[model samples]
Target: METIPSSDFFIQFWGVRGSIPTPGKDTVRYGGNTSCIEMHVGGKRLIFDGGTGLRVLGKSLLKQGPVEAHMFFTHYHWDHIQGVPFFTPAFREGNCFHIHGALPADASSMKQHFCERVLHSNSPVPLEGMHADLNFYELICGETFKLDDITIETRPLNHPNGAMGYRVTWQGHSVFYCTDTEHLPDRLDENVLHLAREAEVLIYDAMYTDEEYSNPKSPKYGWGHSTWQEGVKVAQAAGVKRLAVFHHEPNHSDDFLDNVAIQVQEACPGAFLAHEGMIVSVV
Candidate 1:
């Protein structure tokens, strides 16, 4: 098995559910929260997506004191961006956050989606009055950028509204985060393959089971999410050492996720399902 680095870098999952946040009796085990993950690199915090889990993430950060944080959004979808307005860190005056993601050329900007309330149109929260210094950058895919000691490489994902997968490398360790993507077992994109190459951890969207993906009642056929079987194939093909299966289906129970994890491990030895509050150290 490939081991992580010794730099003390770690990733913590705040939310792991896909599509919508599931809050009910059936979802407590694997967590019904939506997409949010925190990466601590070189003493700095980097957040991936701001789903409903951001509520908990914000409280945790607030208690830890103000810190410079960056949010790397996969896309402007509701489940991924809805937690922005509620993030406690964003409401603080001295705290700052940089929002980076892909955008449509014809649309005004990614920020507009937040302002227009495509998801939470009735929600009372507003971004204009936030005290944090915010910066928005719409990055082109396949570009590499630096954040302190980390080098981030972005690649466009195979999704409806378009999403970007990020590969962060620093101090001889690398983590590839690519959620909300869909792929076939035998076919893979060169860019995605390159991004996952030699990665210590690959956090990917394995939202559907093989049967669900191919079944008639599957809600996500054309919605752009991969099954665990497909995810395993891609991980193996990309030479990924460990695969963290993410973006669980909203209706899936913890038992279902447990079974899925076992199946994925059988296919690829290092596959595991991402659970709420699950933390992995890369160093």
Candidate 2:
């Protein structure tokens, strides 16, 4: 395990889009990749989700030489795990990765799901054939764990097939990653509030605008995504210092997101739209 000096913490967004990868001119500003985030805390390389952005992150890790990483999954949805096969480090002999996630009720283990994802029918390369040393851990929701000097807590989120939210704390600074989740109307989710309470940063799912989420003709109420408006409410209730509006809807273009950012700022002055390649310091 890697250990950084105390109080050193940083987060980088490799992918911010939700549902699927949307590569094209319309999405160039925010990004086309799905949900992947990289956090460096207490000198450890901690990754949240393995979406399409993981491929690019893997290449960057390779350039830095052999590495040992801990990757946590929010769920096993296609967009969240689709980049695993393209993660170059997984094919490298000297690299290693410890995968962690809450297994679904139907899945035997995290390893099984990963193997199934890379099976002959789904991927060109097989998980068994990967050169990197890989390990898997099935995390229980609400459990707390430690990596070096960093502390991590997990909570179940409201989403079809189930998902997890994570809170990471190091040297008193904290960051919460909450995505692919739906929030109930009129009240903040206690589970999410617990993970986000007083944190330095909160990265949340804001996949739709309030208008889109509540559109009578095409409401996305049960679509398992929330809007930035809700995110602001959560941030305010949790007393978070900064809010990162994440999990961008696939069809939302750059202009639309710009408007969303403006709205988010007006609602929550400390909040900003999460975009590919954006870096934030937790302290």
Say which candidate scores most in TM-score: 2
What lDDT is reached at residue 12 by model 1?
A: 90
Point out where model 1 deviates above 4 Å. 1-7, 108-114, 117-121, 216-220
Off by over 4 Å in 2: 1-7, 118-120
Task: Quote the positional error of residue 170 for candidate 2 in Å.
Answer: 0.5
Q: After superposition, how far is residue 230 of candidate 2 from its true place, in Å?
A: 0.4
lDDT of 2 by residue, 1-283 (tens): 1232244688989999999999999999899999999998877889999899999888788777789989999888888987888998889898889999887777787788678653326687777668999999989999999987889999999998889999999988899999988999868899999999999999999898888999999999888999888899899999999999999998999999998899899989989998888888787
* Candidate 2 weakest lDDT stretch, 10 residues: 1-10
| Cα misplacement distance, residue 117 of candidate 1 (Å) | 5.2
lDDT of each: 0.82, 0.89
lDDT of 1 by residue, 1-283 (tens): 1233455688899999998999888888788889999898887788999898888889887876666888888887878876777787877888888878766676587677545643256656666667888877777887999987899999888888788999988897899998889884457867678899988899989898888888876455668898877778778988888899999988899888888888889999977998888888876
lDDT, candidate 2, at 257: 93
